[model samples]
Every structure is written in C-alpha cells, then in structure tokens.
Target: MRGSPPCGTAVGCMLLLLLLDALLLFAGQAAGEGIITNHVVVRLHESAHDDAHQLAVEHGFQSVRKLPFGEGPLPLLPPMSPRREANAVPRKRQRLQKDSRVMSVLEQPGFSRQKRGYRDLNEMEVNISDPLFNKQWYLVNTGQADGTPGLDLNVAEAWGLGYTGRGVTIAIMDDGIDYLHPDLASNYNADASYDFSSNDPYPFPRYTDDWFNSHGTRCAGEVSAAANNNICGVGVAYNSKVAGIRMLDQPFMTDIIEASSISHMPQVIDIYSASWGPTDDGRTVDGPRELTLQAMADGVNKGRGGKGSIYVWASGDGGSYDDCNCDGYASSMWTISINSAINDGRTALYDESCSSTLASTFSNGRKRNPEAGVATTDLYGNCTLRHSGTSAAAPEAAGVFALALEANPDLTWRDMQHLSVLTSKRNQLHDEVHQWRRNGVGLEFNHLFGYGVLDAGGMVKMSHEWKTVPERFHCVAGSIQDNHKIQSGGRLVLTIDTDACQGKDNFVRYLEHVQAVVTVNASRRGDLNINMTSPMGTKSILLSRRPRDDDAKVGFDKWPFMTTHTWGEDPRGTWVMEVGFQGPEAQRGVLKEWTLMLHGTQSAPYIDQVVRDYQSKLAMSKKEELEEELDEAVERSLKSLLSKNN
Candidate 1:
C-alpha cells in the first residue's frame, strides 16, 4: 500500500482525470456517423406524359394544390431562401467550385434577377388594343366598334349590357390589404380574406394602406376598382366581388410558411388570383415546395363552386426566361391557370424636359424605377404604370380570369389551362420548345408566354362547357408548418403551392426514416435509413438524405436515395419510413453517443451545408462594434471603482 495522497492533490488529479474522460467521450461522439440533407438532380415529366411518379409532389394527389395544366415553362433560379437576405452584395462568395453535389445545388438553373436587359418592361406595350384583350362576343372596341376589352369605356358599355361581374368571387392572394381603404370597403370581402402571415400580428397592422406602392392594392385596382366613379381607370372585372387572398411576402420574395399556407383556408374562394411564383429560373419546375402548390391544385381539382374552381398564377416579373414561376404557383396538372405576358414591344414616349418622373411623389429623388410605361395602373389610378415584366403580366392575366369566371363561374382550373391553350387565337396550335431559355425566343405557345397572353374571350368561349376529369385524380398536402408536429400513426398532409409567388422550389426533409437515431457509425451507414412513402405508394421516385456527423448534422457527401416505389393508389398514401440495423451495425457500445435526426423530414438540402455565408461577415461587423463598446464601458466602470476604492 502507498501513503494516502494529499487531499488537495487527490482532488486535482480526480478533476484532471474527469476532464480527460469527457474530452475522449466528446471526440468519440463527434467522430460517430451523422446524418444530413442531400439535394439530388432530378428531371420529372409533366402530367401530359402521365409519368407522375417521377416528381416527389404531384397535383393529382393534393386536394388543395390548384396548379393548372400545361406547365409552359419553369423558373431559372429559386427565390432567395426565406431565411436569407442580400444585406450586401459581397465581392466574392464561397461558391461550390468543383464539388458536384454542392455545385449541382448552386448551379441549379434559375432565372437571374440581377442581370440587365431582362428589365426592359418600360419599352414594351400592354397591347390593351390587341386582339387578345378584345371581346367580340361581349361588345365592340371602345370606339372602333369591333368588340374589344377596355377599362372605363368597355366597363361602362358592359354595365349597360348588364355585365357588372356581380356575384363573382375574385380571390386575390397577396400581401395583406387594408380592409378599411375607402376604395376597398364595398368590395372588400373580409369574410373571404384570411391571413396566413400573422398569428400574433394583426393583418394590415398599421392601416398602412400603402397607396402608390401597395402591390395588393394596385393588383386589386387592376382587377376591380382602379377608382370607381373617381375619374380613374376602369377595372377588368369591375362590379366583381373582389375578395383578397391576403397571403404573401413582399414582392420577389417568399417564405416556406407563406408558400405552404395558401392551401389551408376557411372559405371557398372560387377564382384564386395569384400574381406570384418561384424566384428560381423561369422554367416551371417543382420540388420540395410541391406541398403547398399541390394542395392549392387539389383545391382547384376539388373546386369551390359546384362546377369547379380556378386558380390563376402570375408568370413572374423577370419576364425574360428568368424565373417566371414566382411562388411555385404555375399551372400544373390540376384545375389552375397560369398567366404570361405578351408585349407589343412598345413604351410611352416621355418628353425629357418635363421629366416629372418622381420615384414616389414624396421621395423627391430620381425614382427607383425610371423606366416608365406598360399595362400597369399608374398615377391617380387612371393610367397604367410603365411597369413591365411577368409580375405585371400575371396579374393582367388574373384580371382576365376574373372576367371569364364572372361570365361563367363553372370553369375549372383544368379548363382554364387546356382550353386557353387549345383556343388561344395568338398561338392556336403553334408549339415550340422556347420555354425559359435565355434566347428571347418564342413560338406560339412558348413557355415564356403560356398559351400566348391569356386571351380572356377565347377562354370564356372554350370553357362554356367542359367535363370532369375522365378519372380525375385528386391529392392534398397540408397546413405548412416549420415546427411541424405530425402525430404518430397519423399522416402528414401537405399543402401544394406550385405557383411562382409561393417559393416551393426544392423538396426538403431530414433523413427519410432515421428516427431520433441516438447512435450511428460509418460501417452502419446503410443501417440508419429513411424514406418518403408517397401517399400513392408510387415509389418509382428517388430519395436524397445527407450523411450526418457526430454533431447531429449530415455532410452533403453522404447523401441517400431510395429505390423507386412499386406503385399504387391515386392520391398517394403516407410517406412512412423506419430505421433498423442491418448486419449488426450502428452498435457503437453505449459510450453515450447519439446519432439522431428530426423525427419526420423528407427533404435533402445540399446548399444548406453552406448558407447565408455572409451572415458571419455581417455578424463580424456587429461583433467588433459590440466588443469595442463593451471594452469602453469596462474601462469607465473600472476607473470609477478604482477611484472609490482609493
């Protein structure tokens, strides 16, 4: 036996030993196998091909996904993640140079809003006098007497002919609107509007009835009241019961919640007007955002009216082949309609000497958008703004949709897409592959201009009488939730919002089935698994999951995929997955390590591994300033305390 160690020595030794053990444990756990997200390259076929399983989210399976048919084109780039904002354009970004996984995510084709030339809207023509906006069936041109669609003149004529668009429900889905605005009162279908943006915050909190720049108000004015009886311009569907959807982020941006919330609503809004889509490339593609979009499409397929429902999606503002789909709200294989632009390529000639072109009547500076002139409603609500782009185009089309629905509320979303294409006088039967490519190319019903400028009169005539789907397939997602709490054994229904305004860009989820995996290792890589069991049991699909690390995070490299499903059901079943050990792996002796993951995640984000990289840069600036401030305060306090002590 040895002499008893000194009390102090023993205590110190014990503490050192404990610290060593803790270090070892931390190292071991950190080196343990982990899970993460993975975005796989995918190319899905459109519904016209009937190969629905190719896409993770399809409209047929979503009862609320109001996507239209004939998805003309997709956007180029996805909108900025709701979690990120361009505080400052960095000179250099940490891009995924050669990493295919990361590069694929970074290089995913999407429209570029930063590029020039795409914003030549000030030079285009609204073609208000074009044949498309005409309505030979309704009446003659404002003065030409050949039957055209005009504002005040045609509206007055229509009223005289008993066409006030009364009894029609026009749903405008956008940022919250001021229900108390004088112009919106009589028409503000508050009972029809709902806010998915605010829970603790009230809708239109400040009564900031943002007049001149309010996107919702401007859009509403175009659709209904530009300034009823106020010598202002007339509305497309004047006298129409314009009910705002009251759901949207500011323009050119969106959040998952906003994207997902479009489907879960209380009232049955017949004609849903969406002047929004994904900020991704202009091509009309679908991904994780399919839930909200698909749900909206489901709403369409199911329809509010006995006849059916129709959802109108705005093509997008970056008109050229850029991200035309604003919020994933483009026409998919459902009862939805997409609106595009058709510019006569003309602009209002403004004399320079009187360049009264003020940004805001209050800004007193050179305006933000100097390029002026288009179909958009402008000053005093009488003239259209010089604004051009798919943003304005989509609303223009939505306005036309309201009119058609007013004429015949029985039109379904499918009728809107298919019929519009088949009957479009501009591109009646012309078909070309000139979608969202950067060629400024077009051919009849090109992707850039779905069915070539929504010809309202044509759609009205075509949809007079349509049929129910031969074997109409319907599906639904659910109420979009970030902190989703899906009950055990219960299904996670998704709300599909494929419109461009709704940013449902890529499908997202944690490892498909890796339940709170408390332990994992490299050897048992395949053991800890997850899967997306499409509601339809249609598993001809691929899955992607990231390989996690000891930190409970997965690196993009160790992505996972699933063997396509065998196939079954129409509206898809639950995506159930289980975790199990294969060949006795994942058993790293309980040294107290946890290889866990979120309970129910179906998405695999490759770019998430490197996101908001600029956040650190911004934080550094703030952190330094804070440190300096703290140092100064400490100095002052110390001086005061020392003097008192002395």
Candidate 2:
C-alpha cells in the first residue's frame, strides 16, 4: 500500500491472500478427496508444502517432499526403523586362537594336511650350567650329569659375559592361566590379566578352573617359576616375570584375530607368548591379515613395563610333511623365532595312561613317523598326559626369554629373536642336538621340526657372552623339560574326560550342523582359522554375528560370530582344538591351546621363583633360630642371678 489509499494496492492485497488460501486448500485436498483417482505429479516448493501444496515458480527452494511425509508409519511391516543385535566375524581360513567356535573355509576339500609322530629320539638329558668346562666339550663329550653328547658351553659364556633378562617384558598372549597355580604363581605380576575373548574387563577365569589343553600351562612352567624353593621343578629362567592375555574361545579365526586387535570393550591388551602358525608344510611366509601384523609391531613398540615386548612363536606340530616354504603364521617371519620341541628329559617313566613312553605317530605321504615326544610340566590333576606338536616348543622359548629379561632388563623382542638365530648352526648343531638327545631319529632343520631344538640355559647366557645370535645351534640348554616332545598323526583320537569315541552319541551329533563357541586366549597372532579333517557331507557356515552387534570392524565392542555346520568328513569326536583361518583370505592352522599352555608355562617359574628367594639350604625359618638363641640367653641370666644371690 505505497500511499495507503491506492485502489490498485487494495486489489493486489486481496489477490495475495487468495493465492495463500489456494495453496493451503491444495495441501489438504487429499484429506477430503478419498484418494487421487488419477495421481497427479506436481512441482512445488519443498519448504512450502507438506508433501503436497504448490507455490509460485519463483520460490527459492527445492521440489516437494514425498507423499505421507509426516504420516505415522503404516501399521504392519517392521517399524520404519529396526533395532539389531551384535556379533563377530572371521579374518582367515586357517588361523586358530584360544577359545573360538568356527571352522575355516580352507577346510573345504582335498587340502593337504600336515601330521606326524613327534619323537625327540635325539633328545638328551643335559644341564649346560656347569662353572667349569670347555664350552665346546658339550658337543662331543657328555654334559654335566645331563647325558647329552656335549654341553651348550655358550650358556656359561653368556653367564660369564653377564646377561640376564633385566629390561625385557614378555606378554603371555594365551588362554587364561591360574595366576595362582602353585606351579606358576610366583613369576606372575600382581596385576596381569584380561579376557580378550569374552570382553570381560577382568581376564581371570573361575577360581577352580581346569586346563583345556595344558599346553599353555606347561609352557609357562618352563619359562619362569621362582627357582630353588624346590616345590616342583626348575624353570629355564630362574627369575623372570610373566603376564597373560586371553583372546580366543574355540570360535573362528576371524574372531581370534579381531579379539587380538581389540580397541574397544574394546580389548587392546598385548603380551608376548607361544602361539601362531600350523604345521602346514612349514611355510614361514603365511599370508596373514593386516591387523595381526600391525598388532605385532605395536607390541614391540609398546612393551610391558616400558622395555618393549618379546613374542615367542611355536613353529607348528605338522612335522613329517612340513615344507619350509609354507611355514604357517608367527614362525613365518624373521622377527618371530620358531621353536621346535626337544626331549628336555624331565618326565615320569610312565604317562597318565600307564604307558611306558609318551608319543604319537602320523602318516606323511609315504612315510610312517614314530619318534613322538611330550613336553614337561607339573602334573595337572591327571598325572602326565601326552602333549604333542610345536605348540609345546614355543612356550619353552618364551620361558627362557622370561629368565633373560629378569636379568638384563633391556632386551627387546628383536634382541630375543636375534639371540635365537645366532645360536642355530645347521650341521654343527645337529650333532650337538644329537648329543643332547642321546641320538634318536634327529633331523637337521628340516621343514618338519623347524630349527631342531631349544636350549633355555644356552639362550639365557647368550646376551652377554655372544656378540651375535646363533644360527641353528644354541650354546647351552640351561635347564629344560628332559621329556620328549609330542607329535601327532595316527588316527584323529578325540578324548574328553574318559569317554572313548562315540560315533553316534556325542561328536557324531555335534558334527551335524554344529554351532560351536570357541574361546581363544591371547597367545598367538596373524590370521586365525581351523581346517576340520572330517567328512565332506557336512560343512560349517557363518551365520549373522548375533546377541550383540555393536561394530562391524575386526576388533570392537561387538564382534562375536556364530557358525552353522551341515555334514563333514568322517573322523573322530570334536577335535582337541578347532581348525580355521584368520579371514576369507588367510591360511589354515590348528587352534592354539593358549589356556593350557599359559598354565603350563607358569608351572616351572612357580617352583623356581620361590627357590631363588631363599639363600640357606634347609628352607627352615630364620626366625626360629633367633627365638632359640633368646631362650638360651634367658636361662643363662637366671642361673647367674641365682648364684649371685646364694
């Protein structure tokens, strides 16, 4: 109304009001029209319309909103938005971890399997810690009370040179171990535990827990148990601290690898322990997932107690048919020193089954291997059980690292790896190993057994005495198991409690469309998986991750996976461990008995750590001696007083 009274102005105002009313009328037309019989498509200002009405073409906005923009969701089909549960995923086909439940795709068909009897035929009863002796004499002459052909004199040299694990920190990435197990209690740090498997903030298992495989427990015992108290046996390293990290559960390799790389619930606990790889032709160049490699690098860079971490890996249990070119995981790299089982010689004359000797055999292509052996450890509730494979060897090496770290304090994982390599001497050490073994069917560093055997004492002293790591021949064997190593390959014999193989009852039924929950301990790394050597009719299939679906990444708040199986090959019952891979593109491997190994590793240190704490031989109370002296003094005073008074 420019001038307030123009006739044109009044007419224009009326026209504008009319236009607004028309728009509103159009927007609500559907409400009264029963429905559009001819569906008209109109262009309108998005902001001006309620999924309807149209405005002038000059409006500065986008097109109209879709019909029913603000209407309540249609009554039936799942509400506009739906909620979901969480779960986990796999990373490979053959990497197995602690507690996991899923088989790998590699377990498909006709894949080559690695299996063989483990016999440390050349394993010897040797102790290479003598103060007096030509270090080299151990190779040709018998050792000090240890029946070996020669001594790993280098052990003494290292001791003389002054090297003990002082600044090193080893992370025991395996199953949940009994931090308080008498056999492995002392060496554990007061605060060291985390269940990467279940995402439980506290890694401790139940108070009265039984070991799944004992592989971890045995390994721990060998690594460090307070030495000298004499409750059980001595550890390779006399004084060293060890830690544990559980990250598996008979699940899938994908589950294991993801757990290892946890960043939320988020588990990110890192520890160096025995794990990784399968006896798959001994290919040291296994194509692991990216996260596993990153995790390893991170561990070394972020060591325990600030010194850095040392990870010890067991090469594999597939001896007889191993090919150096395909050595599986952890052992696949130079950073990881592969371990082979040796007859450290500390064994009962008979095994739990009352068998004269403990061993397992296998058929590798055209040969029959019978030289199987068992690693040593404190007796689990059940006497001595046969533990087979390189699975046992990795823990042995880890134990020595614990001892060395207890002394030196600055040795890094690299240092430990270097020491291992510098000591191996192909042929020269083969003879020494034979001497240590009393000469059984000992082969050089063939694909079957990696680089022969491990020497705890020899490794302990190497840091100071030797300038470079040994290559195939460790100097001294420190104190070792003395028992034979376990090698498998006969028929797949699955034993649980005391139940024999039940074709129709237990395992047979489980193999039919099974859904297992595998829990993996944080011990081994790289891609995880399992290769079930069973019938073909049945197969394992990955279902949607469930119950808890938070994140989709490898490691997160929600990544537990569930798999369903149909029919598989005809074999034994459930395997002691599952077979799988870390991911869709990973290699197959045997699940690591991280929990059993954790406890076993602690056994030796538990006994030895206590022993080293003492200085006197009797192990009696020093306080008791002082109390006796006081009594005698009192008696003398009374006699003197009586004489004076008389």
Candidate 3:
C-alpha cells in the first residue's frame, strides 16, 4: 500500500475487484424476490390427508388448504434469507418425494397471458343514427370496406326470428369490461362479474400505463353490447347479457388461480369466453396445469346443473409460423376453439390451421387497415372503431352461442357442438390453402377455416329443435410402443386395429374426435408432419411442420394431437398414422410412443335414422327446389319487363 503495486499486479487486482462486484450484483438480483413470493404446491397420499397440515408445518411449509377438492394443498415456506433464492421446484419435489406422505410437489410456474394489439381510436363525427352499424360488416355485410356482400353471421335473420339471446349470459374472461360504457351498460350482468385478480366482487379491469385494458370491453361489445342504442354497432346477440371476469390484470397466473377463474360462478355463467393463451411468439409451447385440467373436466361434468358450461377459446394468433396444435387450451377436446376469418370470407392471415379448431368467424385481415377490425366498445366511455385478432373472433362466436342458448336453454354443451357441425356453412375461398373437404358425416371442413363460418340463423334454428346428443362414448387403442427411426425424406406408418370401439362398455360408432398422444425424438421439431387416416379412408393432417421450432435436442413428448375431421367415420378397422420428415437436418428421429383415443356417441343406430331422415328431407327439398326455381324465373321476367318500361 505504501509503495503502490506493480502495473501488471495493479491491473489484475482491479480486474479481480470488478469481478467480485459483478458477482455480488448478480447474486443479489437472483436472491431478491421482486413481487412474486416463493411458494410450492404439494399433493399428499390419501393415507396422510388427515395430518396434511401438520406434515406441511413440520416440513416448513404452511398448509394453504387441507383436503382440497382436487389436489392436496401445501404452501412451502419462503427462503431463510433474502441473499439466497429458494430451491428449484424440481429439486424440492425430489426432496419432498423422500417423505412417505408427499405424493407430488410443484413450484408454481409463472404464466403471461397473451395480449392483443390495437390502434388508438380516432375521433370521428357521427351524424347518422346507429353510426357504427354500417361499419360492422360482420353482422350484416353490405359491401362496406370492400367486404363481401351477404357474408355475415346472419344475426339479422336470427333477430327477425325473435331469438336475440334473451336469458343467456356470457362471461368475458379477460382483463375487464367497461360496464359503464354506453353500449354495454344496459346488458351488463353485475351478478355474474367478479375480479379474481384483485379478489373484488366487481371485475373491472384496472387502468395501467399501457392502457391495453380495452380488450375485455371490445370482446364484451362483440358479445352483448346493446343494440338500437345508437352508440356502437350491434352485437351478434344484442339482447344477451355479458359479465366480465377480470383475471388477467396481473402478469403472472397460477394453476390454482386459473382453475378457480374457469370454474368460478359456474352455476350462473352459461358461457366462459377466453381469448388469451401462451405467447404467439412461435417458440413457446404451454398449456394448463393438472389442477386446471381437472377443473375444465369438472366444469363440463358438473357445471350448469350437469348441463356443462360452454367453454369458447380463441384458436390463437400464431399464424403459419406457429401452429395452434401446440396451444393446450385450443387443442383440448373440451373446448370449442374458434378461428378467425376475414370479411372477404377468406381465412385470416394470422389463422393457424389446426385440426382442433371447431369453427371460424369474421375478423379484420392482416392486409387491411385496423379500421377494418371489429367495431366495438372501448374503455373510458369510448368506442373502438377497430378491434382485431382471434381475440375478437371468439366473442363473436360466443354471442352466436348465446342466441342458441336462448333458443333452447336445455341444450347441453355437446349438443351445441353438433349444431355447429350441422349449421356452419362452407365459404368459397379463393386460396387453395383453404380447400374444403367433406368429412365422413358429409359435413364440409377445412383445417384453415374449420367447419367453415358460424351461421347465427342456422345455429339458432337448429337449437330450437335440437335433440341432445347421445351420451359420450370413449374407446382407447392400446399404445403402439414400437420404435422406428425416421430420416429426412422418409415416411413411417403405424397401424392399429381399432376393434376396441365395439367393446361392451365402450360402444362407439361414428367418431366425433380422434386423439393421438405421440412421443418422438427428432433433431429439429419443425421437420416433422403427421397425418392420420381413418378406417373409412378419410385423412386428417393433424400436424403441419412448425417452421419456427428449431430446437435440436427435444421433440414431442406425449404431446396429444387431435382431429375433428374424423367426424362420422367408423372406428372399426385398421387405422393408420403416418409421420414424415421433410427437412435435411443431418439428424434422424425416432417415434417412441403413440396412444389412440376415440370419442364418439354411443348411439349405434342413430346413423341409420339420420340417413333415413336425410333421404326423406332430400325428396321434399327437390320438389321445393323446382318450385323455387320456377318462381325465381317468373320474378326475373317481370323485373326485366318493368325495367324496359321504366
């Protein structure tokens, strides 16, 4: 210190000091709990249920709940000091497994719900009454904004039929809805709204610096904003009521929170409409945790007095770069995944072609201006002229569902799905990518457009006379555990005898959905595409290549891929699955495990009855068609003569 160090030694010493400072900073940051408190969820064996709380306390975790409805509850203790972070949940799980009473432990994973982007609203002068009605081409298209004429939900026809969504309620499960908005106030159902994020009775979205809180309001307007009030455009179901479930205000969502949110007030909430999910960034693949999964099952099995709550989810905005097959919520068989179509009746640019998507609805196109987006209510007592994305598409479907519910309040969730299959009309798109094909049941379906666009009039009319579907029947084909190596430009086929569909307790005739839980190891996940062939020779392209997934180490692991294209197909012969690799990634892949699940109606004789009825209706329709043609010709002649005289 007195003589001063040598130049080299001094430099080394200074560098050492800098290293120490950096280490301290990093360690402090890692150990400092920002906003999230450390907590662990533990499930115990049934034998230890009575002493669950005492065991949790001994293990230094507080018992959040004992004998929870679904899972055992134990909240682990925080770190002893702020200087050190809590152990990883996986590590803690291993440690907890040492205890005979502990069954499982999971560190709560943080989730960021997807957010939709919208342009700022511009002030516009309004002179005409119902100013925005003319702009809502989705409700009644009149060639506005270059949109196709007569390409709409046919809500006007439904309204004329006196089915305007009365006595139906849809919960907008988003940030919040501006109930005070002029367009929505009249139809706001305060009794059904709740803010789970803030634990408040009123589920109002909080205003933040970003001000993206208008999402729920826009969705609400699309579902049940009042009609003829002359504020914004009319909703698909104008007379229906909408409630807001403000659960997305926080940045992080837990399994328990989401489960509670989905099942919250299930007795009164007829339909839960959600537009948010894992990021649309293309690289992320995520879904609900086990507790949330169980909750969805419970919702369908027990909610709404055993009628099942209708769950509508957005198909996602990940586009061709990313597929919705990776989205857990949209891919689930329990949810009705709604995709988006443009006003021109083409598949939206951002629409990811997934077999799980049930139907499509109108939304703004990627090439069009935001003004072409959905015109609906916004926050702050204002109305948005444009709200876009699959987010907007879902609530539109919900509104249509509300009308269906009003038409027949007793229709179960599965009945509503059958209505969609029978009523959704196939739109002729100019693009070949949106090619449509008939499923086994003679219903036209497309991966890009699903079962085509929702027809509000058709759904409501059918709902009025809808017979509830037969009880659900399930059959499982044992796992094909063989391993086959797949190389670039190679294809592998696996076949299974599906005679199990004829089992005594598992009676299945025509299929509703087919699921394949697959395990594959590939050099790159994006290089694989899978196709499933039904016993009747109908092909369902379950997975297209994901171009954005470049992870070289891991591939699909028990990832379930589903298809609705197998509808009405016999599940009795040898079914085949083909996996192909298209890329030359210099590495090969192996298919490890595949399990097949067939879900169908147990009514074996219904198909014959349906065929008989169809034949009878076809004979009557032919006679009516000739008469209608003759009347149209006579009307045209009269119109021509009138034009000549004028």
Candidate 4:
C-alpha cells in the first residue's frame, strides 16, 4: 500500500534507510572535496548557518555539504553562478556586516602539465644484464685508459657497506615513468606518482612508441630500479623507491602547474630530481614564478619530516651555445646544481661551466670513443643500453643522495650540502679546467666541476654521523649604481669590503653561496664576460661569452647570478667583480647597477667540532693498530723462546 510495503516492513525499511544515510555521510567526510572544485568554503558562527544558507541561496550557491570537524560549509555553485572563479569573489561580501559569517576566502590553486624499439622480453633482459655492468665505468672504473681506476662515483663500496637506499624516496620530476617496467616495478612508489598533464594519478608516459618518451623511465631506473633481478644492470640506489611526476608531458608549462608538481606530496617525497629547466638557449633568461618559488621554499622547510626535502638539479646542457647562469632553476641558491663529467673523468663538451654548480658526476660524452652512456631500464619492460646528458647525471647524484639518506635518515637539506662539500673527491685528471684552488677556508674548489665528483662511499660514511650546519645567515650589500660605460678592450673592476658580515644574529664567516645581481645594457651581449674574485682568491666565472646570444640592447637586468665556488670561504674580506668586453670591434656596454647577497653561517664552531672529532677518531684508530702490532710481536717472541728452550 505504501511503496511496495517499504522493504516488507515499515520499521525495517526506516532502519535500513538510516544506516545507508550514515554510511554516505562517513564517505563524504572521508573523501573531502578539493578546495576550489566548484565549491566555496565559508565558516559561519555557531547556530548562524540558517541565515548563511539563506544568503548563499539568494546568491545561487547551493549548500551542498558541511565540512568535516564542523569547519565550514562547502557550497557548490551552478555553472551559471556569478563569480564562479574563486579569484573573482563578490565585492559585496566585504561590505556585508560583521555577522555575515564569512571568515576568509582564497583561490584554491590547481595544477595542469618514452621508449626504445621492439625486442623479445627474455633476450632483452639477458642483453641488459651485468655482462655490460662492467662497462659502466662510472660505477667502478678499472683503469679505462682515459679515466683513473677509482675516478668513479664510489658506489660499489657504498653497496658493500650495505646501503642500497632501502628507505629513501626520490621523485623524478620529468615526463613520465613506466611503472609497469619489470626492472622498476618492484621499487616504484605509486602513492607518490602523479600525472599533472592529464590531471590523473598515474604518470605513465603519453607516448611509448619510441625512445622519445622513454626518458623518465630511464631516469627512474638510474635512481631505483630493482637490484639483481636479472632484468637490467642496476640503479645507483637499486633498493630505494622511485616515483614519477609527469608535468613536462604537456607542450607548455605554466608556473602554477610546475608549483603543484614540485611541491606535490612533500610530506612523503624525499628528494626531487629535476633534469629539465627553462630554455637552455644562451639568449633566454627565466626562473620560477612567485608561486613556484614559494613552493620550493616550502618543500625545503616542510618536507621529509622537517629535515627538508633535497633538490638535485641539472646545471644545464647548453654549454655549446649557452651558459648555465642563464638558467634560473640551476643557478638558484635553493638547489644543488649538478654538472656532468665524462666517463673518462673529464668535463664533457656539452657541460656548462657555472659558479652555481655544486658537484659533478660521470655521464656520456662525445670526446670518448665507443661513447659510453648510462644503461638502465627502458620502456615496454625492456632496458636501454644508453641514456646520456646532464639529465643522466642528475639522477645518478639523486641516487647517491638516496643512499646517504638510507645510511642516515635525519639529514637536512643543508646537511646533505655540507657533506657533499666535505667528502667529494677533487678530480686530478691533469685537465686545465678541472684544476682546483684553495678558497678562504682552504677548501679546494673548481668552477668547471664545482667541489668535484661525487663519492658515494665517502658521503654515506659521513652521513652516518654527520652534524647539521648552523642556521643560515644572510648579508646584503649594494645597489651600487655604477652606470659606467664599458667599451671594447676595456675592463671595469668593482670592489666591496663586506663589513656587514659580523653582528648579533647576522654573523656569517664561511660562505655557501654569493649572488651578484647585475644590470647591464650592451650593443652585443655575446661580447661580454664577467667574473668575481673573493678575498681567498677563488675566481667564479659568473658570465661567459655566449656566441648565440646576440641581443644587443638588453643585458642582464637585475639578474641574480649565483656562485657556490666560494663555499667555506671567509665572507669578511674585499670582493671584486671584473667585467670586460671580448669583442674586437668597438662595441659598447653600460654597467647599470649591481648588488651582492651572501649566504652562510658562523661555521668556525662547526668546522672546529668536525676537526676535533676527526682527530679523536684518528688517534683511537692509530692506538688500536699499534696494539694489534704489539700483540703480534709479543706472540712471535714467545714462539721463538719456546722453540729455543725445546
């Protein structure tokens, strides 16, 4: 008689309906709506919802649901609703009385942003096995003629130390990674992977037909492909977790989209390995937008349980036609800029020289024969025999970081940098560019290779008992408006004595990075070269002649050129900048304005502590060795006496 007897009984039907309602409510609260997903969130005074609902309804916003924990209402507006976009809120809300129940409204941000040829699976796996592993000279060089026997990443020893990066997570901010690849599947972390291009969760490359879409998968394999699985050679951190962030798949990348991708899942993702950046062309100069900058800062300040997320960036691959300083992301003080060394342990031709570079790692180079490139996992469950570029180098360093993290899980972003400076092996390959000189603190540095090649064993050993650096100290000097005209065959040298480097809460002795913000106008930008010399006599080539950069009228405009070459150097002495023109013709340039920002800390205490620790350990080790020797000598004497008495 009433709705087919209402589930055969009135009371039973009512109870069933109530249970379903409760389940639905629970589900809604659990899967909370996105902040700006066609909804406006508004918190109302207790018991004032009735009036708020009336007002919302009057404005055509349907009070769809209440927020969890009694936070507020998530009201969905129709497509035709006025002020649909969060950025365009109604002006009348401000004029409304204090009792209007509107606390705050902000625009919820959103984000939007390959493979080898075919082959049989078994054959490919066999072909990709460790038979070629020995050919990976970057892992353990056995005197490869052109390379020193141990001029490698020292990863094998780290592996022997039982650190395969078991608990670290490195997010590859690249095109896409093939999660289904046999070599990478075991270590891939799906929870940390995302595709900003399709607004989906999986980050599989859009195209898998050829090697073009295989970049991310290759990079993933380098970071954390499965180990000894008979699938591929192995990754640097073969037991670590790798996740892909597919933001570069889109043709164009906006700042908001990049912000979302870089800062995605900061609480979970540990290290972000970014190989791509703004146009590497010499003429182009670009960097992160405001949102993306904030995102990077947030990542370091909040990620990895507050130890801070590690960011490894490729310095740039525009060496032939551009300088790495032209690329903003690499030159930014926030990143650990990585440049490429060849398998022969020499600087690669395509590797840009920049003061911002932190360290170097082996990669493919044209200078060597048989052209060795990094081998790792590929598309379609296969493996690739070659993957090269600063792209390849960055992931390798990221893998080393993963190993370091696994060895010592509490390393902050700055701690990693400090360890890098302390343990990296300076290349002594007899190359002119790779020559090293002492900084203010007597630490050797080379602009072509930064501190030097990464040493996984040394880094991991240091990480095991490393102490974090002191809080960062900052000092700024100048807007020295030097509108001096620079003509051909002339040079301008500017000097500033850093007296502001000492004060309460503002003291900095050792340096991490120094940024020179220069403004210049030139008739030919490519004809200009600039360098800075610290009081320690460390020279940083801030700008080099870029033959391809021909823009005449506009030079660096308040451009921030950063250098890490002066690391550990005392920041209290006179700093000099030399700008000169290289062109033979009478071309003119104007040095408009420039500023210097130094970032460091009172590192004397930290350095002293480290030295003391090292000395104590060394003494203990020597005493132990002497005791062992003494015991052996005593045993020999006893045995000789026994023999003579017998």
TM-score of each: 0.41, 0.39, 0.74, 0.75
lDDT of 3 by residue, 273-390 (tens): 9999988877666788999999999999888899999999999998887788888899998899999888877777778888888888888955556557899888877887779889
Q: Best candidate, TM-score-wise?
A: 4
Residue 358 in candidate 1, Cα distance off native in Å: 36
How displaced is residue 351 in candidate 2, in Å? 22
Question: Which residue pairs does candidate 3 place in steric collision?
Answer: none
The worst-scoring run of ten residues by lDDT in candidate 1 lies at 354-363
Cα lDDT tens digits for candidate 4, 330-397? 99888888988876667777888878888888787454455277777888888765788899999999
- The C-alpha local distance difference test score for the whole of candidate 3 amounts to 0.79
Number of the predicted model whose lDDT against the real structure is largest: 3
- Residue runs of model 3 more than 4 Å from their true location after superposition: 1-129, 366-370, 604-646
Please give the lDDT score at residue 292 for candidate 2: 64
**Higher TM-score: candidate 3 or 4?**
4
Model 4 misplaced stretches (Cα beyond 4 Å): 1-131, 143-148, 365-371, 428-434, 615-618, 621-646
Q: What ranges in model 2 sit over 4 Å off?
A: 1-168, 201-211, 255-271, 276-287, 301-308, 324-328, 344-375, 378-385, 425-462, 465-646
A best-first ranking of the candidates according to their TM-score comes to 4, 3, 1, 2
